[model samples]
Structures are given as C-alpha cells and as structure tokens.
Target: MGSTIFTPFSQKELIPKEEKLEIYRRERKLCIGIPKEISIDENRLCLTPDAVQVLVNAGHRVIMERGAGEGSFFTDLQYSEAGAEILENRKDVFAQSLIIKINPPTLEEIEWLQPNAYLISALQINLCSKEYFKKLSDKKINAIAFEYIMDEYKQFSLVRLIGEIAGTISILYASEILAQTNGQMLGGITGVRPTEVVVLGAGIIGEYATKAAIGLGASVKVFDNSIFKLRRLHTIVDNRVPTSIIDPKELKKSLRRADVVIGALPRINQLPIITEDMVSTMKKSSVIIDLTVDSGKCVETSELTTLSNPTVIKNGIVHCGIPNLTSKMSRTTTKAISNFFLSYLLEIDQEGGFENQLVKCQEMKQSLYMYKGRLTKCTIADKFGMQYHDINLLIF
Candidate 1:
C-alpha cells in the first residue's frame, strides 16, 4: 500500500447519509383490491396476465386478493405464475401496499386501507358518499381518478385513447337496442329514406356515433354547445358530418326530423337538456340512446336501463340508457383497458418510478389530488368544499 494516497479532482461526490437511507426505504410494491363478491364476467379482467407480466418486469410486487379474478376466468395459479402474490383476504391486500382497482373501494374495503396508501381507480369517487370522503380524509389516502383527469387536449384523459373503442361499440349497443324496437332500419330507402340521427354533445361518443351512423348510411346531425369542439369534429370528419351549435329553439326544430336521437352530453348538475317537450317533438317511431345517462341523463325520457332490459318506450319514443355500454362488448373493452394499463405502467417504469415520473409530468400533475398529505387538486377541493393547496407548495 502506498503512503501517498490519490487525491481526486472532486468530480465525484458521496451521497448524503440521509439520502442513501431514503433510497433504501423506497420499495416497489402494490396491492390490488378486487371485489371477490362482484362477479367478474369472463369479459372483464382488471389486470390481465399480459399486464401482470409488464408489472413483474418493472420489478414491482403485486398482491392480489384471492378469487379477485374468478369472474374473469383467471385462476389464482394464473396470477401467481404471472408473478403476483395471491393473498387470501381482501383486507390483507388493502393493508399492504398501493392499490389499483377497477371499481370504487367499498366502505368495508376502505376501512381496511392503510393510512397514506395510494389508489388508482375510476371516477367512482363522485359516486361515493359524504361518509366515504370523510373516511378518505381521515385515512390520508391519495387517489388518482382515471375518469376526470385530462391530457394535453383537456379531453377525458384516461378515456381518450380508449374513447373510440368505447364510442364505436356504443353504436353497436344502441343498434342492438334499436333492433328490438318496432322502428325500421336506420338507412331504409322507403319510409324515412335517410334516418334522421341526432347526436347531442359532439364529443367522442357523438363523433363515433356520427361515424357509425354514416357507415350505416343514415343522415347524421351532431349538436354541441362548444362551437370549438364542433369545428374540430368538422375538420376531423372532413365536413362530411353536419354539426349544429345547439340553440334550445333549434333543438326543438331538429327533434321533429330525428328518427334516432343519441345523448352524449357530459355530466352537469342541472335539469336534463332534453325536456319532455323536446322528447315529444321527436318522431313517434324514433329511438333515443342516452349515453350520458350514467351521470344523470340528458334526455328527459331516459331512465336507467340494464343490459337485461335495455329499452323502454317513454313518451312514445324508444329510450335506451344502459350504464355499461362498453361492458356489452367486453372482449374489446377489456383488451383496450389492458393496453392502457400496460402503456401507463411502461410510462411510469421508463421514468424510474410512478411517484417521480407522475408527479413531474405536467398533465399528470394537473390530475394529482394530494402530494405528501396536502391537497393539490383545486377543482376537486372546490367541488367537495374542501380547502385547496397549490401542488407546487405541497410537493416542495
């Protein structure tokens, strides 16, 4: 050993003791709380084997509740082989790590959640009760809602890539309902030569409905409050689809010519856009597909209908307002959802970790609600009558 030790130019620095300790504490693990009580039809598996494989490759541990995938035809052995740990009880999974779920956490399930655990799920929070929010606040749980978050374009963030799939299939769903009705085919030559199709709220669902209608050779007219979105749709469709900025008066006039009306409006806490008078104006033999019926309907005649009994004649117009339209086409919906999950996981993996990557991404940041136990989503806070804190302040 030389007594003359080497002296460095100071390009390399040692990590702080605290920083190294923090790195050691950061582990990759997640728990998936699936409702064993809820029967997963063969069509809808929350996390497919392919998705599990991606997660496994990312070096994250997945803990799943027993029988969680039973409805989806995925046995415990299948998930185990895919590198997921199978836990016997739902509470154990909830208590362990970050949770990813297809449905909203139930009251009982939320009770099992560990404090400060992260959850990724659908926009079922809105459907949750005041009690649920109280529990959420008490537990210091952080959540990312898949539905309300927006991408760069301010569209349905989670549903954007999958919207066309959901939208296109909605037409098939509506068609199935329409087929059961006494009304004639959409593009019949004789009576009602060009079936007058009215698609309200020219968003993704409306655009796809327009496409489906056009494909079926039916005349399509799209109504929207946003002239901007309507114009965008016009450009995308090459002006082939006619769009109208909805005037309440004009809406009445248009309904008279409509053979099939599709409501694709976003949720608003107000009276239905289509009043009984508007429904009365529609042709007696016409059909109404209320896509927005999930968040309270746009059509006055619309009522909640299940896939089992999907249609009812209200005010002499056939109405269909099934909540889970995509579920009707489960194969495509599940595959699309699986692809999204894979893409989301890969995006996180590429950036090192979900917290570091997601919190830094501006689009994801906008969707973030709480960071390090501080309120970050102002809109949600305002909606829920809670105090808002700037995300930057919370993170720092």
Candidate 2:
C-alpha cells in the first residue's frame, strides 16, 4: 500500500478557541491613583463609585489608593461601598495592580511597579529621562499613554473630547484675563470694541475659542497654516467669524489688529512657530494666550507662566502661556479626565482582558512592551538600539 497522505488543520483555526478559554480563566484587577486635596476643587471626582460598580460587576477587583478620589470629593467609604478595596499608601497600589494614574508616575512610584504591570497614564515619554525609560523597559512594564492614542477620526483619539472641553474652558480663562485689562466688555461694546481676538492654529482649541469669543461678543479672527482647516472653520461658524491662512504679509496685518490672541498651536519639534517679529506687530496692550505652552511655547517671546503670575508683557503684547490651564478649572478638568480613564477601562474589560485585547487595540499595540519578558514597541528598541523579540511568538 502506498504511504497515506493526510492534510492538517491550519494553526489559526485551532488558536482562538484555546485563547478564549484561557482568558475566561484569568481575573483582571485595576488600581486607580488619584491625588488628595478636595479643597482645591469640589466639582471633580476621579473613578466615581458608579464606575467601580461596573468593574465589580464584571468580576474585576478595583483598588483605590487612600484619598485617591479625595481631590474630587469622593470618599474612601463611598468606594468601599462600591466594592473597591482602599489601600492606605500609594506604594501598595502600584505594587499590586494594573495602575491607572492621572499624572506621570513619579520615580518612587515607578520603582514600586510590579513586573509586567500595565500602566495607563499621560506619560510624556518623549520628554522623560533616558533613565526613566530604561527603568520602564527593565521592569518589563507596558506603558500606555493616553495622549498618543488616535480616535476613529484619526485625531488624538483620547484627547479630542477632552481637548474640546479644555479649548472651551480656555476662552473663559482669556475672558477673566480680559476683564482685568483695559479692553471693553466682550460683546456689549459697539464702537471700537474693547477686544480684538486672534486665535492661532484653528484646531479644537482654536474652534472653541472662536465659539466662546462669539458668545462673549468679541471680534474673533482665527489663523492657521492649513487652508482646509480655515475653510472648515469658516463654514462651521457660518462665516460670522473670520479666518485667515497664515501668510507673512497677512500675519502682520492681523497682529496689528488683534487685542487678545490665543495661541492654540500644537507642538512641533520643540520649536516656536510664532516668531518675535510677529509678536512685536501686535498692539502694545494686546494679550497673547499660548495654550500650547505645555509642549513648549508657540509664541517665540513666550515663557512659562504659572497661576500666580499668569501674564507678562513682551514685545508690546501681554503673553499668557500657563502650563496647566486645565488645572485652573480642576473641577471640570478632573471629571473629564476621569471619564477618559473610564472609557479605557471599559475597553479593556469588554475585550476580555488587557493582555488579550492589547493585541487587537491599535493604541495598545504601539504601547505594549514585553508579553512574557520580551521586548516590543519598535520605537523603544530603535531608540535604544537594542534587540527585540516578537511578542506574538512569546505569547503564543
């Protein structure tokens, strides 16, 4: 008899059934770290008891560092009732959990992280120290940064919603500053209105600033490099608000007319786009609010401003480049931030677990490090010029 020939089933068909069964057997735990200091803002609450209820119902254990939600007016007792275990020290939370932190983790906090722990936070990895990045790699931890994720629209996914809120609030910030200046009331003035508002970049922040300016009754003109964005803004605002694509000649004219200019430009290679010459063209008493100061100032003459000294006159314009504008409105900022974290948590929970779903999530795909103590994220490997192992091969 001739040797029997047989065909084998493909590996892909046999894989998912085992993977699903494995995921079903594992339990995922999440720990949230929030700051204390409710006296700063009362309207904000991080990881509400309601969100805890959802996690608990999903068969996950939720832990909160003692007073984590105190800054947001959430009590330890409230979280306990919602089925969360409260730990007294922040260190314990990091040691035992998949951590969710609002701010970048401190060096001490980073040291406490368990090996292979998943850390979700607004970690400015590009700006962080090489030592810190090395520690992250050494710990074999997966750091998922909220700022890097893109949404369905392909804009900064996690930040788009929060950016809108921040952008809208930024106008209120400018209004408060405007009220103190010599400018006339935003909307009530008729002849030679008090404020001539110039919004830079025409992104979410610029759009909201335009809306807020219109509501405040200010003469608003928006500027951007993208003619498409400018055209879109003109349509969105029904041409009631004026927008201009930046040209050197037109920029000089616009700056000369602007009394208050909001800089909403995003960061670009740590360089300032609004040159000093452009700044000098503005009115002597004009206010320049640089919202992009977080990435570094957009205005060439701009410097970092704190809540205490939020404005400084430079080259004939008042420059307001405060780093933490959202922090100024902690109540709303905290709630918005908490909601963002909730969305991420729900995504992980719904996908069965972080480890399993991470492969499927485009954002997590970029953020992942080691699966079973092997490197991932090519950027990290390339930056360090180190050898990397494929996570799929290790996991499978």
Candidate 3:
C-alpha cells in the first residue's frame, strides 16, 4: 500500500512540469551520386549544374559519373565547377549512399549499389523484372519512384510537369511536320480552311495539347471514353472546342478531315481504340503524335521512331511515336526536374537526412516503393508476384 501510494505520476499530477521536446538527431552531410544514363531513350539528367551547386553549398558531398550531364548539354566541367567530384569509375559513383537518375537503375547497376543505399529514380515498372527487384532487396536498398512522388495538392509533381512538356511539344512537332509535308499551317488564313486537329484522351497530355492547338488557331476536336474528363476539358477550354465520346464511326469520320491527330491515350486498356483501319481512313500525310507510345500504342499503326528517323509513314499517314518526347527539350526538362529535387534534398538535409525524414514526411513515405529492402508498393508487388510489406510496419 505504501509503495502504490508513493508513485511519481501521483506526485506529478499535483506538480507543474516543463513540456518535453522532440530533439532531432544531429544533421549529417549527405553523399549523393549521379550516374550516367545508359538507356537510349533516356537523355535527361535528374540534376543540373545549378542544383549541384546548391547541394554543395549546403555542406553536402556530390559525386557525378563522368559524362553524366552530356545529354542535357551540362558538361563534366560545369558539374565540377559546381563542386561535384567527377568520378570516372561508374561503380564508384554508384557506391555512394544515395543515387539519383532519370531512368530506373539497370539490373547491373542495381548490383553495383551498396547495402542499405537510397535510390531516387523513375520507376518504369513495365520495363523491370522480378529479378531486378530481388536484387534490390538483396542489397537492402531504399527506392523511390518519380511517378509516385506527390505534391501538397496530392498530384504527381514531376509527372505532371513532364506531361505538360509532352503535350505542348506534340502540337509543335505536329505543326512542323505538317508544314513540311504539305505546306499547311496550323492556323486558319483568311482564304484558307482552319487546320483540323483531332486529339485523343482528355487527361493532362490531351488537355494541354488541345489548349496548344487552340492557341495556335487550329480547330480542335477532343474525344475520350470518360464523359467527365471530356466535360472537364470542355470547361477547361471555356467551352470553345467540340468534344465527343470515342465512337469508332465518328472518330473515323473526323480522322478523314483532321490535319493533325494527337494520340494522348494512356495504356489503361492495353488495346488501341484507333485501329489500323481507322488510321488508314485519316488524310494522307496527316501527322499523328502518339505521346503514350511508351505505355502502349494508342494508334494501331504507330511505330517506334527514333531521333535519327523521327517519323514513320504507315497507311500514307505520318506517325511520330517517340516515347521520350520530353527528352526532346532536354535542358528545360532537366532544370525543372532539378528544381523539384533541389528542394527535396534540402528538406531531407534539414530533417537530419532520410531516416528522420522518413518518419515525418507523408509524401516521402508515399513515394517509396521499397523501404529497407522490403517491397512497399502493392501495385508493383502484384505485378511481379512478390511478397508485399507495409511501409508503416517497416519504417518504424
């Protein structure tokens, strides 16, 4: 009875006490690595020279593989000038604790990673194998995917930015190819008919493509299976453009007169709505830009057109299905990506690095597909037939 009555809590209940504070651990100098992209389709760098400068100035160590920035016109000297150590050994760059890239690391590159290393890159899960993920788990890596990275509004920050670029460029490239092929302009002239632009899908890529076509004075007609998205796109453009559901007959009829067809459909169904027969119905030399070719072909006849041979002719229609459309504007895309990453790195720095940041940031947690060698993304796990672990369970 005496022991039960002499408790510290019983005494504290009657006594005034100071509040306890959460003291964060000491901040550590982050060592980040940038490896040169070996993928032919990926020509954009994750961080630019300016971004490296900011990180270096903040007492962080930056290691860059030699020739890492050449694709974006950022020379090794530029990165060196920004205080990054230029490492000729690719393996050495990958040895750092944190690695960033435009593309997901190749299976070989994953083997180069050290145990418990942190990775930030595009997670093109479509291109990855079960073996690739197993290697990551074996190394006990922490991986974040750019596609899952969210902003304050819960929208994908990096993906939307790249989608915006892709949308605008689709119209621009179409106009250029149209002008060169048939000497027809995108806009209407006093004596000439208005250029008819047909756009598929009403998502981010399609929305901005419609806006761009309208801005260039082209007559834009948008089609989508979703009435809501179509209606939203109509309102987004001030109800100035005509909208329709993706009816085969109506779409085929419109294709006959379309001067440019922008294919912005994603691979939700994995089947092309616009068939080869429908593509054949379009006007000869009409430009078709399949922005979602990387996901899957929206146009049945669209082919993989590389920079060397930028356009392919199928059924007498000019088709451009370059998957890495944003890479065409490499410098601009790199800078935008770098700006987003700069703030992300700085926040992690202030939070005493990845471990503490993992506990605090919801976005960071959401972006991670792998946490300390455990699979956290159900979508990826399901696709690859792998065991899934909850990030909440693993992080703590």
Instruction: Identify the candidate with maximal TM-score.
Output: 3
Candidate 3 to truth, TM: 0.89
lDDT of each: 0.70, 0.69, 0.88
lDDT of 3 by residue, 1-396 (tens): 355455556655978879999888966799999999888756799898989999999999999999999989999999999999999999999999999998888889999999999999987664577998999999999999988898768889888888888899899989989989998899877878899999999988899999888888889999999999998987888756888998998999999999999998876337887899988878898999988776667888887777657898888999998877788888998998999899988988988889898888787789999988999999888877899998888766
lDDT, model 1: 0.70
The list of candidate 1 runs beyond 4 A from truth reads 1-43, 70-77, 124-126, 150-156, 188-192, 370-379, 382-384
Worst 10 residues of 1 by lDDT: 18-27
Q: Each candidate: RMSD to true structure?
A: 5.5, 5.7, 3.6
On a 0 to 100 scale, what is the lDDT of residue 385 in model 3?
Answer: 85
Tens-place lDDT per residue, model 2, 245-349, is 776788778888887778888654456777898888777766788877756467888777776788898875778876556667765677677676677777776
Candidate 1, 1-396: lDDT as tens digits:
769756664435543444433332233544444434342232354577667877887777778777766655667888789988887877788886577776667777778988988777665333456566666667888777777566557666466644676667666665665666654676646555777788897778788878887887778888998999898888877547877887899889889998788888855455788899888877775788887775657887788776667788877888887656666665556666777767776666566555775556766766666554556666556667777878665553
The candidate scoring highest on lDDT is 3
Instruction: Count clashing residue pairs per candidate.
Output: 1, 3, 0
**Residue 223 CA displacement from its true place in model 2, Å:** 1.6
